[model samples]
Target chain A: MRARLILWGIAALLLIALPPLATALGQPYYVDLARRILILAIAAISLNLILGYGGLVSFGHAAYLGIGAYAVGILGFYGIANGWIHLLVAIGASALVAAAIGAVSIRASGIYFIMITLAFTQMLYYLGISLDVYGGDDGMRLKSRSQFAGLVDLRDPVAFYYVALGVMLLFVFLTYRIVNSRFGMALRAAKSNEARSRAIGFPPYPYRLAAFIIAGAMCGVAGALYANHTGYITPGLMAWHQSGEMMFMVILGGMASTAGPVLGTFALLLVEEVLKGWTEHWQVILGPLLVLSVVFFRRGLAGIFFKPDA
Target chain B: MALLFEQLLNGLQYGVMLFLMAAGLTLVFGIMNLVNLAHGSLYMVGAYLAVTATQWTGNYLLGVALGLAGTLVVGMAVEVIALRTLYERDHLDQVLATFGLILFFNELIAIVWGRAPLYSSLPPWLQGHIKLFAGSTYPVYRAAVIVVGLLVAALLWYVVTRTRLGMLIRAGASNRTMVGALGVNIKLLYTVVFGCGAALAGLAGLMAGPIYAVQPGMGELILIQVFVVIVIGGIGSIRGALVGAIIVGVVDTLGRAFLKPLLGTMIPPTAAEAAGPALASMLIYLLMAVVLAVKPAGLFANR
Candidate 1:
């Protein structure tokens, strides 16, 4: 337990200190890329809460990202650029959608749940494409970054990067707490054996639902950060492919481990960046790489490195 | 009213195309207990092959036939090379692998054909419109699609219901181990089954090429709709694929066609104009959610 605490402490310190150091070293682009990785890591960690812990293979998690992004773009477009307000609205909108969608989706298990979530996300994609307002298929651009009350300057890339890093660390800490808590145990038990969990006098449905909502809210924050980072939002943000990519990040990193998402996001994004630079048809290489990883490595990179307690 | 009828027909045509793709997906899932995400990639290959074949043979029909045959071969090859190993793996693994295939195929296509959309036209004989009642006209090509889709549907129904192969397929879906114990060559059967699914997807792509732009990433666009069909109709049931396809196709088409006008009547025109398209686009998802709520297994779950 002491070892675990020290590991987490080191992780937290690195998360806080790495970006400023990169900025100090005159590698602002590297810091920006790290910020992007952290943002996606935040999203993937939320996904792990339900998928890794609760065993719900949701294919539509990217829809929450899209929802959160649209919230920022739409609210900002309407002249409400307060950073806190936009973040709150984004989280609320995503949570409400998750609650409504989860109520129905959690009814089915296995492949059915995956397909249903994918279908709902596709519906959202089409909605985004068809809406004439908010730039429709072309996507809308933010005139400016969200403004804070005399404190944070989001337009500054360094400040924004730090904020993203802070948010990611907070989410990582929260996920760690939730997974180790009593509620977390119930969720893990449900994943192991639903009938056994039920026999032990714990209902899995509400616990799973709560986890799904929490995950969605967390992803919403990532979505807002993504929008701010790019200063643009499009229907493609909610596409089924995006959802698939998010799932890949979780599995690629190491499902169920706290550091898994962080590692996975960095690896996946870096590979993508490198591949895109090498050739336009990088998917040819990357796609097979993904398949090989799944077929060969049942345990992800974190699994190979950290060796979680049995 | 005539215009409405035309739109309805258009929806049916689109649904029929979707049914072709969904039928193969449902069949493979029901029989093999495998979730094939690369199913869309197969659809894409069919379109590319059709375009290539047409250029080679100068006959659209022959090109389509070759496309179907080529896709079947590729399907079997993929099953033997990649998917055969994935049957016992978790769905998460299946998803990741198949997603990889999607990327590979998309890039491969881009490398070969360039990233621009191809203009695949119909034969001169199939290009004109057929006159319906009064003076209304519908595309002759669309009529051919409906006829071909119905015929394929009938053929699939016969294969799944009356034939020995159908019986084996049904048995396999229920219990693979039992079929293996009974001395059936389960590996060969899975390959053939996956091949048939690929052929069906290929057929859908070939037919869709004329109506929708045939491009590198076309498969990904239709893949989600096919998933919706299987979800609503119940996975692994061909009959369910048909019904679900029609329902989704019609609803999506009609919603896009008249949703704004329908809302305009009930609310402020400006508000209706603003919200109609968004609501219309999401109608099918709403339908899927409601169906799942009422019947968690599906509308016609095979098991």
Candidate 2:
């Protein structure tokens, strides 16, 4: 428990310190990248809730990112610029979509769930493409960054970076708490053995559905942050390939670990950045890298670095 | 009326094309219990090979034949080399590994064919329009696609129901250990089944080349619809794939084609125009959701 508290303290300190360090070093680009990394980490952590803890390998989790992004983008296009309002709309929209979809999707286990989630996300993608009002295939651009009512300036890189960091840290802390709670125990039990969980007087359905909704809402937060960061939103956000990438992040990070998603996001982003700089056909390299990771290093980066305590 | 007939033909053609894709997907899942997300990559390979073969041989028919052969060989090779190792693993592992293959194939295609979309022209004989009824003319190639798809479907049905291989396949799906205990080489059977699935996807890709743009990301686009078809039809059931594919194809194509006009008759024109395509595109997903609600295992789930 002391060690856990120290780890959280260090994490909180790092989150508070990093952006300022980047700005002090005159490396604003790293700050921006750091901010982007935090947003993805938020999404990945949420995914870990369902995938790592609940053992529901949804291939379409990126749909929540798209839902969150579109919520912000569509609302902003109609002249709502408050960051809190956008965030609320984004999370609410994602939770609603997740609930509606999860009601049917959570019925099927394993591969069917993955495929159904993927198919539903694609439906969202096609809808985005067909929406003539939202720039259609070209995508919509934010006229300005989201506003925060005199508390912070999101348009300022440093301020936005800090805001992202603060939010991410809060989410991480909350996730840590949730995973150790009664709900988390039930979720983990369901993952290990659904039949056993049922035999023990716990109905797996409601817990799993609630987990899905929470994960979706968390991803929605990431999506809203992403739209504000990039100042653009497109149908590409909801594509099946994007979902694949999110799953890749969860697995790469070591699904069940607390810090796994953040670490995985950093590793993947770094690899992508470095490889793209080195070669035009980096995916050829990346494909094998990902395959080998699953084949040889199934425990992921976190598993390699930090052995979980029994 | 003519327009409606034309749209119906278009829907049928699209449905047939989707069956070619979905059948392979369902079969592999049914037989091997493998998700095979990279199946679409095989389709892309088929289209690329067809384009290359046509250029090399200077004959469309020769190109088509070579494309099919090449895809079959590659499919078998992939199964023997990569997928064989994956059969014993869990579905998540399978999804990840196949997804890796998708990344590799897309990049490899881009390297070989360039990032630009390749334009594949139909042969002159297949290019012209044919009159079907009263004065309505349809593209001969599309009509040919429908015929070929139906023929393949019939051939598949016969092979699955009337042949020794079909018996083995059914047995493998239901009881793999029992089939193996009977002295049948389960590994070899899996390889063959995967190869067959790959070939089907390849055929779909080759046929889709002239209809849709052959490009790096094309596989990803069609893959979603194929998944929807398989899900609604029941995973691992070819008959379900056919039914699901046709239902999705007709709904998607017709929805895009006449949804606005149909809605305009009932609602205001502006709202109809705005909502038609959006709702149309969502029809299949909505259908799938409804199906799942009623029958969570799917409509024709092969036991």
Candidate 3:
């Protein structure tokens, strides 16, 4: 456990030092890439809350990402670029939607759960494409980055990078706490054995639903950061494959482990970048890589650090 | 009134297409308990193969036949090479593995066929319109698609109900371990079932080529709706897939066609115009959610 903490600490320090190191190396493009990866790590970590720990395999988590992004884009469209408002609206809307979706989705389990979540996200994707006023299928560009009342200038790349890094760290810490809490224990119990959990007097429904909503809301914050990171929002962001990619990150980094998804995000994206650099048909290679990883790396990258369970 | 009638027919045609895709998916899900996201990729493969074959032979019908056979072989191969191991794994593994297949197939198609979308032209015999009633006409090709889809569904029904293989499939779905103990070649059965599912998806794909864009990721566009159909109709039941597919197809089509006009009458035209498309697109999802809320196992859950 101490070794794990030390490894995580070193990882965190490296993340903190990324911007300066990348800039000094004259590969400043990597800072921007690192920011995107950090934002996505937040998304992946949130997914880990439900998928890794709670055992709710939601295939539509990208809906929250899309919603969060659209919140910023639409708000910016109407000239409301206040960062606080963007964050609030993103979280609130995603939470409400998640609550509604979770309420219905939790009634089902296994494959049904995965499909229903995917269906809802598809519904949202269709809605996004139909919003003609908001650029519809083609998507819209954010007019400007969310304003922070002059507290932090987002226009500065370094400032924005630190902001993203800070938020990601905060979420990593937050997820760690949640997963170790009493509520987390209840959720995990229900995940392992719903009937047994119920017999033990903790019904899985409410806990599962709560975790589902919390995961969605947390992902919403990532979406807000993602929109600023890219300066664009589209229905494509909520595409099923985007959700699939996020799930892969969670699984690849190591499910149920707080730091695992962050690691997975970094690993998957970095590999993708390298492959893209090598050839245009990168997904052809990446696709098989994902398959092989899933088949062979049953425990994922983080599993290397831990002893096998009996 | 005639326009509404024609639109309803269009919905039926669309529903028939969805049924073709949904039937195979439901069968695989029921019998194998495998969630094949890459099923869409098979549909895509069928379309790509058929289009290329048609160009080679100058015979659309022959091209489709070759495409169908090719997809069946590919499907069986996939089952053997990739999906065979996944049968015992968790659904998460199945999902991610198939997702990997999707990426591979889409990119592979792009590499082979170029990223530009291809157009599949209807043969001379399949063109023109059929008069339904006074002042109403529907395209003959669409009418044929409906007929073909229904025939396949009927054939599927007959096979599932009357045939020995159908009995085994039903037996397997209900009790896989028991079937294996009973000396059935379970592995071969899974491969055949997967292949049949692939052929169905391929049929849907090849037929859809002319109507929709024959592009790399075209399968995904319809795949999600097929999931909705499967969900609404209960996962394992063929009847449920047909019913769910038709309902979704009709609701989606009618909503898109008339929602703006319907909403315009009750509200400002501009407001209706803005909200109509969005609401129409979301109509089926709302339906699915309602169904889920009321019957989480779906309307016709097999077990």
Give the winner by DockQ.
3
DockQ of the candidate models in sequence? 0.85, 0.82, 0.87
What is the Å distance of residue B39 in model 1 from its true position?
Answer: 1.2
TM-score of the A-chain for all models = 0.95, 0.95, 0.98
Judged by TM-score relative to the true structure, which candidate is superior, 1 or 3? Answer: 3
Which regions of candidate 1 fall more than 4 Å away from where they truly are?
Answer: A5-17, A20-25
**Model 3, stretches more than 4 Å misplaced?**
A307-310
In candidate 2, which residue pairs clash? none
Cα error of candidate 1 at position B83, Å: 1.1
Q: Residue A216 deviation, candidate 1, in Å? A: 0.4
Candidate 1: lDDT of B173? 93
lDDT of 1 at B181: 100
lDDT of 2 at A47: 92
Pairs that collide, model 1 = none
Give the higher-lDDT candidate: 1 or 3.
Answer: 3
| Per-candidate clash tally | 0, 0, 0
List lDDT for all candidates, in order.
0.89, 0.89, 0.93
Give candidate 2's fnat, 2 decimals. Answer: 0.86
Sorted by DockQ (best first), the order is 3, 1, 2
Tens digit of per-residue lDDT, candidate 2, span B1-303: 999888888888888888999998888888888889899999999999999999899999999999988999999999987888788899999999999999999999999899999999778999999998898899999999999999999999999999999999989988899999999999999888888888888899999999999999788778888898888888889899999899888888988888888999999999998899899889889988998889887889976
Q: Compared with the true structure, what per-residue lDDT tens digits does model 3 show for residues A1-310?
A: 7987898789889988988899899998999999999999999999999999899999999999999999999999999989999999999999999999999998899999999999999999999999988999999999999999868978788899999988998998998888888999999898888889999999999999999999999999999989998999999999999999999999998988867898899999999999999999999999989998888899888788765211
